[model samples]
Target: MTQDGYYAVQLNSIEIPGEFDISFLTRTSNLKAGNIIFDSGTVMTMLDTDVVDELVRELTDFVSLPTEKPVAPHFKLCFAVRSTEQEEELPALWFGFNGQSGNLRVGPDKLFVWVSRFVKCLVITGTNDKVQVFGHITQQNFLVGHDLEKMELSIIEKDCTKLHEP
Candidate 1:
């Protein structure tokens, strides 16, 4: 946990490549090697305002879906979809952490939310604050373990509904 009472991880890389083109985040070198606060109490992930602006531009161009005005005040990225089931059409985001062997891949379930019958909004928002927050909405279905002594964080995908089925 950080001194501010939030669990933090060394976020190094963010991947969202285009199969036929280069990565959408190729020019976002400024976002690398930053600490992101992992707070379970917050429902939406919040990145730096400038970072979010760049991401919004890339995602808007990458996703073929029609755009929608934000349903919520906190978010600027949204799309008009027939149903949440179309999540597969959205790109998946992978976040890499230092000291961790593998990247944490967040699918549509963790990246988006259904605001109305035909509206799906990105769960991540932009914040003017210096701290980048990784919220609970993006941590759903994952088992996150924090090792204070080693100063490391671990995340594993799990079916939380059946954690104690034994």
Candidate 2:
């Protein structure tokens, strides 16, 4: 959490590998200390322009789908999925954090938002400014806890959609 009491955490890096190889083409590991913010208020994650550009490059190379020009209100990276089957072909992404935070994997279903049955837009985007944000969509299915006294954040994986069940 920030000094103002917003639930936020720091990240060490965000990485996306090449389409056909494990070699990473885009890795934002050298971020300034405590620069990234895990924001619950935002719907989409945001990164610096250079980072976003590299991520776009890697994703474009990885996803073998027809490109669609970004339309209004969906101006990040958008693609045309021919069918439900095509949407399943998108590659996974990862977020790495400092210390024992480990790595968080984001699959295609979590990475893209379906605008239509045939159109899907990337949930990650670039910011004109230097603000790096970890948005809520990526936080789905996780129980996040903030310990103000200890100055620590705790994240536990769980099925958030099933929270109401006994």
Candidate 3:
């Protein structure tokens, strides 16, 4: 948690271009410490407008499918997939924290959603607001633990359905 009462974390890096292993961390100043906050109430992750624009650009170039406007007003990027299998064409995206050894890997299942039968959009949106939110969509199926005493947050993927089993 941050001193400002936000559950914020420092984003160390982002892996967007999978095959080339390229990171935009050095290219942008928006990836600053304590810029991202975890918010369970928000259904979709929201980044700064500038950050989202850059991501949209990269994604538009990377994804071979035809692009379209999202049916919803919030989302800025959408793609038309021929079938569920075409979702595999999306490259992997990961968000790494300052001190964490494992990056939060977000696959197509977690990253994209079908707004319509043929159109799928990124689960992330751009916010002109002050705070950038790491929403529940990306945090799905993960057990997130916050240690207020140590001011730390831990996230691990789990089979949520079997969590209550002995």
Model 1, 1-166: lDDT tens per residue? 4445666666665667443222223323223344577889889998777777777887898888899999778878998988555566888787766676257788887898889888889988988776778899999999998887876778899989999998
Which TM-score value belongs to model 2?
Answer: 0.81
lDDT of each: 0.75, 0.69, 0.76
Cα lDDT of candidate 3 equals: 0.76
Candidate 3: 10-residue stretch with minimal lDDT: 22-31
TM-score for each predicted model, relative to the true structure: 0.85, 0.81, 0.85
**lDDT-based ranking:** 3, 1, 2
Question: Candidate 2, which segments miss by more than 4 Å at Cα?
Answer: 17-33
* Global fold similarity of model 3 (TM-score): 0.85
Q: For residues 40-133, could you state the per-residue lDDT of candidate 2 as single tens digits?
A: 8888888776766777777787778977877655347889988778878776777766544567777777788877767888888877654577
Clashing residue pairs in candidate 2 are none
Candidate 3 lDDT over 94-136, as tens digits, reads: 8877665257887777888888888889988888776678899
Count of clashes in candidate 3: 0
Compute the lDDT of residue 102 as modeled in candidate 3: 53
What order do candidates take by TM-score, descending? 1, 3, 2
